[model samples]
Target: MGEGAWSCQQSPAILLAMPAQPASSLPNGVVQSEATARALIDAVVSNELSAFRQGPLSPAELAAQTQQPVYRALRCIRKWEKMGVLRVHSVHKRAGRPIRRYALSAPSFFIPAQVLPLEDVAGIVSRPLEQQLHAHVAHALREVVGLQGSEVFLEPRRYGAFLVSAPGQVWDGSGENLPVLANRWATLKLSYADACAMRDELDEVFARYADRAGPQTYWLHLRLVPETSKA
Candidate 1:
């Protein structure tokens, strides 16, 4: 078989029946950004394409479903195929021309923090859902007196997720006893193994509460980085 070509002997039924694998389970499943990755995933899991989610699709079919030009669709599929995010499920001969059909190599992808450009990060925060979150947080802070000059904003980071800042002191509506917002920075010295252990422990703590039923929602962000120089 030629490169990128698949034989018809591979059962389409078996391929379609295989369960979608998570990004962590597949090599090359981690991406730097969600741009093309998110769109492809949506194409697979979206209700509009429910009938074909499990099966492979031709570039023309993907173009129609994604509302992109056929050439562009083919180019994207080929690029993803090179990245190992997609693979040829089969090729069909139509009118003596071979048409390639592709399927996602994995259904899910993971994008590491700080991998997106600054503008892309800004674009994400500008989306409707994030805008709503900002509005809600702002309204709640407005009732608290000491936060008059305080503002919550994103701090661009070179090595991790954007750091959210609400600099200076923040007080609850009562205005005296304890602060409602917590922001702390600490310098730690630890062996590599100890650091990894600490991170694993924190992951467990986050996972423990990740799916708990609750009346209120809270956002928590954490980062652990090695210090390179004194500021």
Candidate 2:
């Protein structure tokens, strides 16, 4: 996605809902300058996409959803609209200006994955093709773990299925050795069939938002490594 990928955004903001509040309840910290558009985009991509698609942000919803001023939020919405991620789903013709409802053209905004080739990579450099793949995975794992730290989830399967998400929440995975390593990382070893299911879900989600992040927005880091080894 290059450097400018993270700053992109959508318009007709539906995912965020500001709650009904008296004028006094409006956040004093509303985004001041247009320069803060990057922050609005960041918040939308990182946390609001799932919610926005459901409906438009009512005046009440806007106050409840974001601290940015309504205009600033609108700015982000217009930007996203320009990016082509959001589109008109409906229009509420009020007494005054028409209220337009927007929907996401896609579910997710994709953040580019970074693959750093390790210097003097062990296990991979001199190993057979099969072993080299293992080494490659292991090396990639280390890099992902080192960067994401707490964000990199690893839970054991004996506890239950790790890929399962609750209700509308997604982004779930766990590993067997996770219990052993309080601060370490491990793979979410699913049965081959189960692994395939998780892979499909991830691919779906990844495809949805893979290209939404703008140029200046902070990137969300994600990596999935699966293992077929028996317990």
Best by lDDT: 1
As a whole number from 0 to 100, the lDDT of residue 112 in candidate 2 is: 17
Q: Ten consecutive residues with minimal summed lDDT in candidate 2?
A: 116-125
Scored against the true structure, residue 61 in model 1 reaches a CA lDDT of 89
C-alpha lDDT of all candidate models, in order: 0.54, 0.42
Per-candidate TM equals 0.39, 0.31
Per-model clash counts, in order, read 0, 37
Clashing pairs in 1: none
lDDT of 1 by residue, 1-231 (tens): 122111121122211224474332236556655564444333333222332356678889888887889998788777767666667788888787799888767655554545544444324333534555567666666555544354453445322222222443333234464225444456788999998888788768866876677876665545576777773
Cα lDDT tens digits for candidate 2, 113-215 = 2221222121222233345445554554464322232222344523322222343232233444321111224466578788667767766775577667655
